[model samples]
Target chain A: MAHLGLRRFPPPLMVLLFLATAAGKEEYGGGSGGLRFRREGGTFKVLQVADMHFGDGRSTPCEDVLPAQQRGCSDLNTTAFLYRVLRAEDPDLVVFTGDNIYGADSSDAAKSMDAAIAPAIAMKLPWAAVLGNHDQEGTLSRESVMRHLVGMKNSLSGLNPEGIKIDGYGNYNLEVGGVEGTLLANKSVLNLYFLDSGDYSTVWWIPGYGWIKASQQAWFRQTSSDLQKRYTTEEPTQKEPAPGLVYFHIPVPEFGSFTASSFTGVKQEGISSPSINSGFFTTMLESGDVKAAFIGHDHINDFCGKLSGIQLCYDGGFGYHAYGKAGWSWRARVVSVQLEKAESGEWRGVKSIKTWKRLDDQHLTTIDSEVLWNRGSNEPQPI
Target chain B: MAHLGLRRFPPPLMVLLFLATAAGKEEYGGGSGGLRFRREGGTFKVLQVADMHFGDGRSTPCEDVLPAQQRGCSDLNTTAFLYRVLRAEDPDLVVFTGDNIYGADSSDAAKSMDAAIAPAIAMKLPWAAVLGNHDQEGTLSRESVMRHLVGMKNSLSGLNPEGIKIDGYGNYNLEVGGVEGTLLANKSVLNLYFLDSGDYSTVWWIPGYGWIKASQQAWFRQTSSDLQKRYTTEEPTQKEPAPGLVYFHIPVPEFGSFTASSFTGVKQEGISSPSINSGFFTTMLESGDVKAAFIGHDHINDFCGKLSGIQLCYDGGFGYHAYGKAGWSWRARVVSVQLEKAESGEWRGVKSIKTWKRLDDQHLTTIDSEVLWNRGSNEPQPI
Candidate 1:
């Protein structure tokens, strides 16, 4: 559980090499809007807050806290940690990779869920989420949890994908459009997919934790295909599917394939993956557009590893209310997708996808920074 | 590891209904002629011999044998076991799924490999093979082992897929042709795939047993696609891609997703999968052609479970030199693909795929008989 994931190790030096200046964000004018970057200097940043495990509106006691930090420690500490990261990062989008609340600790799941989502709403930032295995244990059903999130302010997550029958709620995709007024503005420069990995086993045969099922996979793949076709139709010059990212709770069993030494960051415990693999990793891999996937559920383990062509990453345990080792700091992951500029200096598509983690420690130190996928990385293409 | 695969559990009852009085395999006069079944009563039977772990000739001491059985046991016992199964099953095809020779135990890997294939050679059956993790631990480079296998009599194993570069050797496919003189004679009614699931980790980033690589997966998908197109072209009225079966040495890590109670077979050991999942299961699922994948690496774990649409199964250990519990008899698996006759009583295509295992005890106990897939099973189609 404590072993870090793959590929983040290569970045400390690379990020230092590219201390590129940044411009403010741009307003992309398209239905696939809500995210954009300037041709000259801007980049789209996404902050992944994993396993917040918020309960009871900042009053619940945090687990795995140091004695000295426990004077007034509670869910407030988790809130404070998130505020610090959000203030420091000012990300274009926030992604909560599940366990938004510790349902068992809360008196009312819906009320506790509001507390969990309050920061993103208060910040007026567009955010999206998928539920963890524990999100349904209290007052509300899993479907209710997702519906509530979708109805929240500035929320981009869908209750489910449109026009398709699939497993689980909150199975949807959001398109991050390119620069405004450009021919590519209609194109989804970056695509993000969110899927609920379910709360528990539904059948006696494939028992253990819930996993992404086949119907959900079929939906994801169809959505991916449609997105790719749309991107190509919008910009015929584009060479591949728009760079995509996936978010889900509960790592697929494939995450356990790596040894402690194989990944970056730290793995403190075994990967608490579902008993059945469900093949989503393969599904995403085949999709070809997905460059990286962010997951939560193994609270103490935060690492990134490149498997096949895609990077399997953990956002690290980002909540004090979640169980983590006392010595490990609660942390959130960040990705900055830099857009490429054309010869005439107009914004093109994604130049690179870079990632790093910021710990909740006093300095708010950025650790495990690395380039996840670059245009020139020669990532595998679909047949 | 003891649990049997998915779909197989329901087969015992269904297979009883079909009782499928199998006809002797037919001689389809086409390039894909090695395997066939007549419209009247034919069925294609394939015997899976896993982890033979043969050493020099017939004089090696077998491990995990009952004391009385050990007194006169040697490699001969394993040879005898194969002969017994072959005689009883009279399979049209014999598939040796890796670990064909115990390189560490053998004085010469090449000579020991000869002994391993002698049964099939003497029996003069059409055979194919893919190597296991232990096959290259001796003198021969993996490439050389496959080269030798390909040059043998009645061998269908390839040095590698022609015209495409990929990871590992012996990646190839064999097509079972339709019955004699039918319009579908050239059509590959039953496609069989064989891939060498490498001997060990070749890269520092992925450690443990060698898993399928991205390049290999790419090749497999391409091959699967090509095969599907050919089948459709050959039989214009066919609704789905032809049924396919893949054979390899090591089980993909997804195999561990099942609980002991979930599968029908006896779980005697843990699934020894590679450190990384190379996306082949998803690839096959996407292909919409593959029905079941047969693998061998974990010597004692014999089970089959369907994931998504394809069934992942292990051929129980068929060699005595391989380690096993004393009472658990070494066994071989059999697949009988029955073909359907047309309304005019001519061969149509594969009607159903059924499987079972035969333990190497007196009476050669037949057990775990089940139908893996049928045209009416409504296995998931490609997205």
Candidate 2:
């Protein structure tokens, strides 16, 4: 009791001291800055980034390889730009939606490419990632590009030690700062069903010993029923009561305009494979309680029409490339939703909303809110 | 132009045949009987089998997850027993050998859990196979497995249409035949090399990429170099005079042991991780008109001692358990080598091995000398 006041330290000084101590440990090195928001009185801000296709080596021109018009940024340059944006915004938490890297031909190149972007990875903020179609290629035959990305050597050596990386192909649930969230969560939230959707083209290529196969759809249906019980109760156990955000790569619910612009004309130039259908998305949307769906793909900044009271939001591509001809440029932004807490400390409903400014403009234009949400209510909303 | 012996055909009979053919056109069905071998003639027979795991799955047992030992034969059973006796008899061309699937964690139950029998794979004449190490766990990552097997799928698939069936892991290759005599005559003799060693234990755990982690030691150093100068002579106009035979699972100089063995003692446990030095085998063995090297993993019946001046006969495992307490058990045999010219005038090598004998007291005594070739020369022979 002699000097309780003497030992007390200021918040900024305490943070600096904690960081200094963490830096001494080899594991904590490099992870210096991250997204952080402090409100004057209890208000906090969070930023969400999805589908940053960094280090995807489709830069060179090849007739049989990438589409001619689509080739622009090399994987290194794109990844470097992504880190630049992360350093600029310095948000509280960055929620990476999916498709972190385009895994296609050369996995080693992709990995070394990832290592070169180590500075961006070291940005210490807590970030969560989910897998996309590009990440699941390993399941088809073993020789898939996804295998290279998820392999132990590549993942460990290529990734920054501090980044909270998650397998895009697996189901995971995480909670940060009392705001519980699930990425590719099991098949249900309030009786609504969800799934990895796999590669929309081939239903047979399930990953991980086929542990997560199409036959598991039955389990998903059952789980969805179980989740509904939690929401039906007057006082839910969790803080967030709003359904849940379903994260995936492709967009759902056919938007004629986007489809026509993105894929329709490509076939005329000799490309025959049709763009995948949104049948899986429609099925998930039919399930109630799936308030929003978040997806990336269809790099153009656009959104689908609201379907069945569900909002679809398409997180724009993280790589630098302008969509259409709007020198407007590419930008990374995060969406934060405030939920109202009930008397019992459980989330009862939506509270307020906040949208962070573009992390940096590398040619990315509009953010597709509908694609990210999957389904939106008829009611009006604000930024 | 030399002469024509013309015979008049009956119009009614010919008309009947045409009508019958037209009627049966819609009734034609597609599918081959899974177990049927058509015969082709040539001197000196050789057998070819790919992806044989000797000590794999069934050798090592895991608690709760696998069945008890002794109740089943591991995938290595048929291949092991057949090779033991096959190697003793010096067959002209024992073409295929590989994948003695033995792993510390592999259990017999895992091998037999599926209806596929290791014996069925070992059925036959003198043969060789490229090694695969599914039996060894942790030694190969899922990514590496896929990369090595699936990466070459397109190239391998283009070789043969009937060979495109996917297994539990979706791995496959090819088997072609030719005559040793014709191989010598055309100066473009049948040259076959068994490639694909499971996962190189040293670099198996790398995180980002698997197969490309480094150039696969087995493929680059061992198998490829095994017949270097013999096929590629110094003179630009003068091509190498002969084709040779090469066989192995994990190529050579890769991860598995090739030079040493634990005949007896407490050190037997350490013998499991054999030093796989493929240099000598690749350099001296199978050069200058050699036919083939029938090989299997060390866990099975591997007769590594060289033969003739060029060919090194390796008849290791034929699918049953490698070596048993009462000597190698299970029965399989390889036919002598046969050579023939293909439509392209290139000599083709073929072996007609079959597995149907029982593991009786008489069969387990000594290895057949007719199929196994003992080394006779000190000079290195380049095939």
Which candidate comes out best when scored by TM-score? 1
Question: Candidate 2 residues A1-383, lDDT tens each?
Answer: 11111112454654464455445522212111211123222223334455445433455221211343345545444456567766665655455454554444334544533443344357754544444555433223222333343342212111111222111243332221222221111111221122343443432211111111212222232233334444344222343333544545545424332343442111111111123221333223323445555555555443333444445555545554222222333445555545445475543233443343353354333233212231233322211
Instruction: Give candidate 2's root-mean-square deviation (CA, Å).
Output: 23.9
Q: Comparing to the true complex, what docking class would candidate 1 get?
A: incorrect
Off by over 4 Å in 1: A1-383, B1-33, B38-40, B381-383
- A359, model 2: CA deviation in Å? 7.1
Scored by TM against the true chain B, the candidates give 0.89, 0.28
**iRMSD, model 1, in Å:** 10.6
Model 2 DockQ vs. reference: 0.01
lDDT (Cα, tens digit) per residue for candidate 1, span A311-378: 89988888788888887899999999998878877788888999999999999999998898999675
TM-score of each: 0.54, 0.33
Interface RMSD of 2: 23.9
Which portions of model 2 miss their true places by more than 4 Å? A1-52, A56-76, A87-98, A105-113, A116-120, A135-168, A173-195, A200-224, A234-241, A253-279, A321-328, A341-349, A352-359, A362-383, B1-383
